[model samples]
Target: MSEIVAVDAEPLDLPLSEPFEIALGTRREASNVLVTVETADGTRGHGEGSPLPPVTGETRTAALETVRAATELLEGEPVEEYRRLTALVRDAFPGMVSATFALETAVLDTYCREREIPLSALFGGPPTTVETDLTVPILPPAEAGERAATAVERGYNRLKLKLGTDVSTDVERVAAVLDAVPNVGLKIDANQGWTPKETVRFADRLADENVRLELIEQPVPASDVTGLADVTRRVDVPIAADEAVFAPQDAVRIVHENAADIINVKPSKSGLLGAADIVSIARGADLELMIGCMLESAVGIHASAHLVAGSGAFRYVDLDGNRLLASDVVPTDDGPGHEIGGPGHGVTPDR
Candidate 1:
């Protein structure tokens, strides 16, 4: 309701509790940019961007620079001109998705907070609590199994195992984890590490071993839509497209090719508005939806959780990015494993 006063962007190197390993590589910390928007009325909103080089092809330096540029575009504008500001940022940095997400989130958060409404309400859905799956990063089979068991003990029923090495080793990893927790729901993410042949072989072997899987995510590279479709047809388990679908067009293409049974929506990949478009496309195509997070702090995770809780469209949530952090920017109860409290995303940042 007031004029925008100032915008600030800063880079953060949030340490991870453990090294996060996937098919692409390992990360010991998250490289994120935190953005804050302040209005003339003294109301402020917070946002965060965690750039995954393998996914968004953005480095920390790029995210910081993009946010700085966005700040310049947004300052001196009316607080209500959020759409215009975000559009300008997107146009200026076409591929800087994470930076755009940070700017959009900060502006929207400020608007919602000033209005005393939850962010979910803006999305036209009542806020609802959702459960999240804990990820078991790639490690030795035995070590991976131990981590899975520990997570199950900590009240998590769903476990997402990182795979995509070779077929035999991947099978061993899955088998070991199953041995550790036989009844836990299993979701495997290959992170575009496997080929069509390897995906099929892995699926067939899992069936032979009587390993029931909840889903398999991104078995093939993002560019290989037809190859993903081939794997989807060959496997009994549901296939979710993560890297394969970043925008509405990508979702449409995947649906047209029957490449995947589900689509993963990450706000950082497409910004909040773009994520909404992707969700619309997925719903129109009768595909299931998932809300995932890049390795972000509570600032970003809280924003994403609000979107997921409000839409009520997602069947799966992987918002444990905060759990992997050694410290959080906001006070939250056990990562996103439970509902956050307060207005907006129920978050109050310490700084």
Candidate 2:
């Protein structure tokens, strides 16, 4: 029996120099849930989860409390296998999904380190680097235009723009971005802030703008699966389900209902393992997949990137969390450091 070790959770404030705004919310500060699990052998592993109110109904305070609850169960539980470790926590804290994920990732990291096996090899395939789409926050039309130009200059070929606060404002913002960055591929995320009618109308407008809208994510609320399917049928741009596809069962429904053309997978909302299952389910249906990240550190970004690289299902990726941060801990290695690299999960924060 592996003796239950130490579990600790703390809060950190990572400031984003630029304000990130979308229809669902806005933020200048990023709150991180940092978790560490230690084994009897004195080996310690670190994992991170960002409490995103827009996606998961978890705040920093709540996440910490849940972390505390989860850590209590680590004292003597076996950590040799991911499933056994995950089951121990799930049975204890039945519904605190993000907290469970935070604890699980830390435990998994420790287990992988013990076996000296890279996380990418354990789960998916060999580690491969991927290109990420840079996100452009909602701003005034002129500022959005300038930001778009700046992103293109910085070597980003794909862009994601925040939309759905206002129809006219969203349109003008997209127009400004397109006019400024002519060859860049564009995608918009409404964060489920529009009505079905509004989503349909805006999608038509985007198609008319000659912008080559890659995919519009969660135009309607998460619960409105019917409305989402309607928008998918009405729009020329493919619809991506973000808020709507959180659980494994949600993936099955979307495929059955024809609600989306692409699914955006974020581990914090669905947990690392749960998100992987969702990707497999989507692949079974022949749906395109995009791996996305919240405003997190390279630690969290690297975990998701490992899964993306292993699965070979990612068509578009948005692992640009490092660029949004004030600093990165890991130095540039021969691998895809900015996109993804290193051993298991490749997350070495600049501590």
Candidate 3:
């Protein structure tokens, strides 16, 4: 095994297929950062960061700056020590977040390629395939219903609708989707757009409509844990904590307070190692796990898919971020997931 020589990062603008909106904001394009790790033996591996500033509280400039400083700390480190290297990145740049894992993913990719094993093997699991749920951003009810139908036409049975603007309008929007396509697995994410009362009211409305939702995600504000618990206990539908659980400590708190029934693990919120911690905490507390994405490119999506596929712990998956991109830095199948059979992440950047 050779020593790591250089770490490089650059911001890449990947255009979206269309405007993607949620309660937090809208994204016409993905603000992604790519990281490249080079070893002394001429091995190169790549990783990507897709930060939703509104959700993860990380900006493109901050991620790039973190990578620059990280390069100084990582150069000359042994590539075989990839796990320790990733934890070092987390310790040095705790605020960098998603970028921390981007570097770690690159290092792990290099290590896996050197060993000629897929990332699933690194996580101690055989290669497996995972299904993903498509998304419909905030839109009018009729339009939302049409989008749901189109997704079903494309062979996806699960759909997540981004809502939270108005309760009545939201109810109508979901009802419209049901009217258009009734038997699909329907999940709504409010992105912290509603109050606890509103969430309960909306759930009751959906119940009256005889809608059996797979789950409701982060309807109330992230800070409102008491309210989140209230809504979770009051509603018949299970509630998943997205923004509410950013770190393992947050997951522990949610467990102690009985705030949520499921925890959403968005890689962009915490890096690979941090994600593992959160997963362990969730499992210990008997909480279900959901793997989500933040509208990243194929590079980022590949890493998350490999992690989820390797672990086989998540009950629900929403890794359709790469599918939202018109193009990506990494080459991959024109779909939402990865076939975790090849070495490392089995990904290479076009650039």
Candidate 4:
């Protein structure tokens, strides 16, 4: 008989020092869902998903509802069948992709555990570790530079600088960071702050500085495909689609329209299956892919890390959610998060 599985979700409030304000929305803290799935064989798997403001309008209450709905669906079905069910019901609830992803994660974890294999192994494991970049949120130029220096000191070789504040201040922040950490490769995330004209001007300045930025993410508004395409044509640096590319179709469309040179993939925004499809679409379009995450806990971060490790398409990755968290959910018996070696996501939160 097929194993019956159950799932659960809880709302978590982890605070950030300051509210992280972007063009999409403001986040005072990260509200996440902790998902667990179990089988009759007495095996259990776990996952977490951080509902981002851009995808869900920062609706924590709605996110909780979405997860609750997902739980009801998982109560009796075979754990592996979740992806199909999720797709069937997702269109009816357009704003709950993050929640859908949380549920999907639990099922994937259960499937991986049942097979006694790591998630990376299921996707073709990587021989080497996946390296990731550190992110610096928007702050005063001097403070931002210090943060960048700290990241460099911590052995990070790449940095993603959050922009979307004053363009002048943003420029100064970039310069300060580069000055402090000269060897760190830099990427700017405008978070849909600039208009097409402003994006062009900003890109020109970044180029003139000869910083040779890795890419510019979401320089224009999220909904303006034409504007994004226009900016892509004018910018010297590669353009990466973040907020603008949430779905596989979005990735395909952006690539087909030449709106971006790279696509940022986040597992929480796109369910595990959707994220895989997005990566495949990017490869088909010959666009580079980066795996990213919101401020999540070890469970979500580890799951994303395992996915990136298995997918060679990820040229840039951001899996630092564990570091951002004030507390960890990984069991005391689990040792360091990196050591959770098993099938599924290897994520069983202590909670």
Candidate 5:
């Protein structure tokens, strides 16, 4: 039996090629925590977690401390007892979702590597290439259009625009991008920055202006599910819930209330196990699934991509976090892109 011999985690800060602006804030760098688990048989498994203070209420310092504490609880355990080990880690760090994700991923990676199998193979799905949408950060209308055009030129057909600053200005930004790349599929993420009324107003204005939106995500605040339902009722565009749903219970409530047409699943926000549960709940409710990320490194993004490919549940993929990074832990054949091969999330950290 394979046994976990050691656990290690470290803080990783990678500079972004350009400032990533969104409704929440602007980030010039990606701050992530990398976790690794080593087995007695000399196999190593890697994982990554990024703590978004605004979204998960976890800062780097807190994440580091929580990860260290959780790893201490996992050392010397048999790799086969992953469920019990993960349950112990979750119980120890109840609110540290990112930390939990890092630990759980390491465990799973180690297990899969020991078996000489890909992570997707465990789910009985053949690994396949997944196309992802590049995000256009909130910018001046013209600048947004230029960026959109550039993304389309680079073989990305789908674009996600960050909105939610102001209704009129948001419309202008969308209009500018559409004017530049007329045929590109478009989706907008408000990041829970708009009120229900404001969300409806934006949708109406976009419709009036003849803008075709693939979807509008998290228009209203996360705490206001009723408000989300209100906006959903008013908008013809599909509404996806990101901040509003973090756990399976949240997924259940969103479906029960019919608050959203889709659920955005982030493994960092919910651990791999939790994400799987959320996927099951979403499929059961006949809700569309989207796999997203939180400004993570190639490690986290690649792991998330495997989840997206393995489940075959997600209709949308927003794994562009690595595109913002100046350097990547997992080097690609091409510079940086959404590609995972080999086994166990594919690549090893250069360090």
Candidate 6:
């Protein structure tokens, strides 16, 4: 029956090369969890989940516990029923979106290995390459500028800087980055750290100062759809919804409210199927899409990258998960973008 014979999970602390700061909190390391699944015939696979307590409100401990419980529900299940099995894990733990994605990724990896197919084919499209924007966390203008310029030197044309602490300093941060690299593509994510008025003022000030942004993301708190819409209507740049969309219904609600022009889709926000639903909803609503990632490792980043590569539905890609990690196994830097080859998520840590 191609049944699962073993399921296990563990916690890991991925140390960051530098400190990460945002509107919500600061972290020196990413707290993550890993899940491993084995089939009756010795086929095995692994998945990783990264939880940002400040963003998703999911701590690593909680994610680890959820994954442990999910493994109980997954053992003895058929690998061929991967979709159904993932759905069961997702339904059994409604709030554990990141955890369920880990389970789904692990299950799908195992299934693909068993069938000798590519997990990159999960979204029904051929594999593709994506250029990602490395993120500079909220820091002093000079530090932010240095990081942005460094990313540019490493062949990244686009850079995303975290703002929303103070509008004045935030503008200075942008200016510093521009000073470092005049023509680099820039995007800002406030992480729901400001009000609607503050958002409008910030965007207008940037426009007045000749600084251009590709998009302004989630300036207000997640649930404030009215405020989000107000900012979107007021700002010259495109407004993107990030934390505001945690599920398919959340995306539909934001669409109905006209809250955002672009919707940021993260696999950690929903299970794989749910994220796909949101992507379809965005397409149906004529909203632009940006595929995002949490502070994930290669295990999780590779899985999400496969989805992004296979879907090819995004206008923007921010898949640099916790970039300054002490050990990022994938060879993402020193290149314009990342590519996946071979089968079953195609993640090799040769770098």
Per-candidate clash tally: 0, 3, 0, 1, 0, 0
Model 4: per-residue Cα lDDT over 1-351, one tens digit each: 246456667786677645565556666778887766677777777767677666545466787787777666567777667567668546656757667777777777788788777877755774235567877888888988998898787778888888986787888988999889888899888888889888888877877888779988888878998899998898888888888877888888898899998898988777677888998898888889888888787777777877777776788887766665556776422121244356677667765
The clash tally of candidate 4 reads 1
For each candidate in the order shown, give its overall lDDT on alpha carbons.
0.86, 0.79, 0.85, 0.76, 0.86, 0.84
| Candidate 5 segments exceeding 4 Å error | 333-337
Ten contiguous residues minimizing lDDT sum, candidate 6: 342-351
What is the TM-score of each predicted model, taking all chains together?
A: 0.97, 0.93, 0.96, 0.92, 0.97, 0.96
lDDT tens digits by residue: candidate 5, 89-167: 9888877888888888888888878877777775557667767899999999999999999888888899999998999
Q: What's the lDDT for candidate 4?
A: 0.76
Off by more than 4 A, model 2: 1-4, 329-339
Error of 3 at 30 (Å): 0.3
Colliding residue pairs in candidate 2: 4-75, 4-76, 329-350
By TM-score, who's the top model here?
5
- For model 6 the TM-score comes to 0.96
Q: Tens-digit lDDT track for model 6 on 1-94? A: 4999998888767898888898998888888877788999998877778887766778788888898877778888899898789778877888
Give the per-residue lDDT of model 3 (tens digit) for 1-351: 999998999988889988998999888998888999999988888888877677767898999888988998889999998778887888888767768868988888888888888877765576677678899999999999998898888778889999999999999999899888899988999999999999999999989877899999999999999999999999999999999987788889999999999999977777766787888899999999998888787677777788787787889999898877887665555443455465788788887
Candidate 2, position 335, lDDT: 21
lDDT of 1 at 234: 87
Stretches of candidate 1 exceeding 4 Å from the true structure:
none
Residue lDDT tens for model 1, 190-273: 999999999999999989988899899999999999999999898999999999877778888998999999998889887887
Q: Which pairs of residues collide in candidate 5? A: none
Which is the better candidate, 3 or 5, if ranked by lDDT? 5
Tens-place lDDT per residue, model 2, 1-351, is 254489988886788868888887788878988888888886666678777766777888988998897766686666786677777776676556667777877877777766666666756687776667888887999999999898887778888898888887889998899889978888898988899999877877766766578889889999999999999998888899988876788899999999999998887667778888898999999999987877777777777777877777789887776567665546532222355554556564555
Least well predicted 10-residue stretch by lDDT in candidate 5? 330-339
